[model samples]
Target: GLGPEECMAVNPRLVYGRMTGWGQSGPLAPRAGHDTNYAAVSGALWGCSPADARPVSPFAVLGDIGGGAMYLMTGLLSGIVQARATGRGTVVDAAIVDGSAHMLNLMLSARQSGLVADVRGQSIHDSAPFYDTYVCADGHYVTVGAIEPQFYTLLLQVLGLAEDPDFTGSQWDKAAWPVRRARLAALFLAQPRAHWQALLEPTDACFGVVLSPVEAAQHPHMRARDVYSERQGVLQAAPAPRFDGAAYEPGEACAPGAHTQSVMEGLGQSGARAVWRQR
Candidate 1:
């Protein structure tokens, strides 16, 4: 059990945290890679999309935050709680591959149960048309998750397609989806996005407009909630999970070695001036 000062050069009650994709001291550890590279190596990247289409990257959320940082945070919080109770330090090494693979546990169980198809594109999760995106008017798009019969019925009603017998009846009919999707696509194309938004936002319909990043930032609801702020002429993301009494500072770009003096002072180490003089 190493002391906090030994690991961090400060009496931090520190939970020493380490995060990497290939893990420390492995064959791929020294090799440079990003979240996509890590995901590619792990089985997590495979079969995320159609077989003919390019594989979806699953974004950085998978390997970076979801796999690495999140686990580290969990471990660190656990260590912090333990240390608060019984005065001890802990080290957390969060490996992205391990975390990423661990996340596939449920999928593996389903596969083993014979519920998941061995073929990638043919699988229910990948092939289902109801749980997908659709093109809209004004060259925009909307996501539709009418997975259940009731929700799908609501979708058809919102689109004013109640009279279309092609969309009625069974929800899981795969062959019928393409026909219904084409019909819905044409129907959605007949009106502008504002029309659909005005109609659908008030209902239980599982439909949403695909807003661009900039559009989302300026969305009236988001602006009203103050979800983002401008700082130093930069649009910085706001601190999340707001608390009732907690205050937050706007994020800023920190220079390398900017906190060196303050950190050393807090650690009771030699001052920057002293180090420069020694050199």
Candidate 2:
């Protein structure tokens, strides 16, 4: 990582962005950490798991991409614009721990509105009867997120539980959630996932199957939208949030140091690469 002040000294107009697990000046700044460690400090890990289970890391979404790179890019771009106008650059301390915690403000705000709980699996979005994943008879999983009253009603109707007094009248009552969840789970587990798909896939019940990568690539919506593409015989997700409603092809991946020579030449330091390689 480039020392923010030291880099700024060399080029006063340079936007110095430091990417780290912790901020540049914090107690943990000198310590090493990974995605899970960053997420744990940010409250992001706690909300992702179930009531009794451990926190799920959600891969590198919360820390590496969401917190570190994305925030750094945004800050660097904005700093570049400002530096151009003022002729003075700035340092952007893009820390994964900071960004991860900042993202929890969304759920924290929901808690203030009485729509979420501080505890995992108690939150409506995590462990609710209509909001969580269920196992089908085929041992496959499916997700349901029928939060709105009308959507919840539709989901229950699809499950043949629309008239059950315990589930029908008190959708928001926390006391009845465990009973409702158990009954709903039983229904889902009674048949193979295909049966539920046939009954609920076309409805406005806010329903969908939890698809693996291969299955996701073959799904109708994914195929129609071109969400996944093959690159060098490898299948992966396409670049997201299309620009102006147009999809753009991404540059191919390359060896880590493949561009070292070209990059050094561009910097008018072509000879420096040989010196560094020797060291």
Name the candidate that leads on TM-score.
2
**Residue 53, candidate 1: C-alpha displacement in angstroms:** 1.8
Q: List where candidate 1 sits over 4 angstroms from the true fold.
A: 1-14, 25-27, 47-51, 58-61, 105-116, 123-125, 245-257, 270-279
Model 1 over residues 1-279: C-alpha lDDT tens digits? 354347655655667877888887678888888787777677788866666787778744688877778877888899899779877767777888878788878878878765467777655566656666666677787767776778878877877777778867576777786677677778778777777778886787887778865676787776766766776667765676679944465657677777777888787875665785576
Clashes of each: 0, 0
Tell me the TM-score of each prediction against the true structure.
0.79, 0.89
Each prediction's Cα lDDT score?
0.73, 0.85
lDDT of 2 by residue, 1-279 (tens): 357677888889999887889888878999999988998987778877778887888854789999888889989999999999999999898999988888888888989987788666778777688888999998998889898989988998888887888686678888888988898888899998888888889998999998888898999988888888777877778887798988766567666888988988999997978887997
- Cα lDDT for residue 226, model 1? 72
Segments of candidate 2 deviating more than 4 angstroms: 275-279
Residue range with the least summed lDDT across 10 consecutive positions in model 2 = 246-255
Clashing pairs in 2: none
